[model samples]
Target: MHFIEMQATARAVRAKYAQVESERYGRPWTAEEIMLGFLGDVGDLAKLVQGKAGVRPRDDLDNALAHELADCLWAVLTLADTYGVDLEAAFADTMHALTQHLDDVRRSP
Candidate 1:
């Protein structure tokens, strides 16, 4: 799926779960709570990816990583959407530059 669609789907799932959690717990999350929740997920991803990290099987990390990464991406997309950024074009440009860097490295002695 395209990045924009993926981001929207992530937001929908987050909203649905937030509603269920709030109803179960008898309160909606405050902005601070939501930001902290996202921060915790960011830490989860960092734990998996940090240098010298104990590596697990890729399959084992997939589900948690997907959710945490989606949480981070959701925040970024929300910002981009608010500012009218063309995320698709930005991503393509960034990736093209990254590929060029890698190609340059491969060509080095």
Candidate 2:
């Protein structure tokens, strides 16, 4: 699916979580809480990365890695939506800048 579609799907999942969370806790999670959860997901991703490199032992690392990556992406999409950032444009611009720097480096020597 396209990036926009991925973002929409992420948002829907986030909304669902917020609905259930509000019912459970009397309030939905704040952006700070979401970021904290994202951090936890990142830690999990790091361990999965180590598993992939043979530094950690795990039989299900491949599947877990994919799920962790998706979790990270979902967090990013939700945060970007919360903050009113256009991630697609930001991502494209960043890639363009990096490519330009690569070109300049190639021309230096």
Candidate 3:
């Protein structure tokens, strides 16, 4: 699926989670809570990467790494949506700047 499609799906999933949390905890997760969760996911992803690189031992390495990556992506997509960021445009602009920087550096003495 395209990035936009994936982002839409992520938002839907986030809404579902919020509903679940509200039913269980009497409140939905706040944006700060979501960001904390995202940070945890990122930490797990880093560990999975280390395991994949043989720097650490972990079980179910393949599945865990894939799951962690998906978790991270979901967090990023949802956070961007919450913050009103146009990720597609931001990504394009950032990549264009990086490409130009690399080209300029390559031409330098």
Candidate 4:
């Protein structure tokens, strides 16, 4: 999917995360709490990758990677919301720069 669509999907998943957290924790989280929880989840993913590699599907790193990535999106999107960033533009610019960098690397000796 494209970057904007992926951003929306990430936002939707974050909303679901809030619902689950409310159910489990007995209240909706503050921004700080959400950020800290996301960090903890990231650490959990690292531990899972290191310790339970066999438990993941196809041994696909995506299982661990996706969780950590989603957490990152949650933090970034939350920051975007707070600061009123144009995430689509930011994403497009970053991707373009990364593609150029990769092309440069590939074309070099």
Q: Best candidate, lDDT-wise?
A: 2
- Per-candidate Cα RMSD to the true structure, in Å, reads 5.2, 0.9, 1.0, 5.1
- TM-score winner among the candidates? 2
lDDT for position 70 in model 2: 92
Off-target runs (Cα >4 Å) in candidate 4 are 41-62, 91-109
Better of 1 and 3 by TM-score: 3
Q: Write the per-residue lDDT of candidate 1 for residues 1-109, one digit (tens) a residue.
A: 8776876875676677679878889876655666677688788788756522555445456666676787788766655554678887999999999999999999999
Weakest lDDT window of 10 consecutive positions for candidate 4: 51-60
**How does each model score on lDDT?**
0.72, 0.96, 0.94, 0.74
Residues 10-95 of candidate 3 have per-residue lDDT tens digits of: 99999999999999999999989999999999999999889989997777999999999999999999999999999999999999
Residue 40 in model 2: lDDT: 100
| Candidate 2 clash pair list | none
* TM-score-best of 2 and 3: 2
TM-score of model number 2: 0.95
Pairs in clash, predicted candidate 1: none
Please count the clashing residue pairs in each candidate, in the order shown.
0, 0, 0, 0
Model 2, stretches more than 4 Å misplaced? none
Error in Å for residue 21 of model 1: 14
Q: Which should have the higher TM-score, number 1 or number 4? A: 1
**Structural similarity to truth (TM-score) of each candidate:** 0.53, 0.95, 0.94, 0.51
TM-score of 1: 0.53
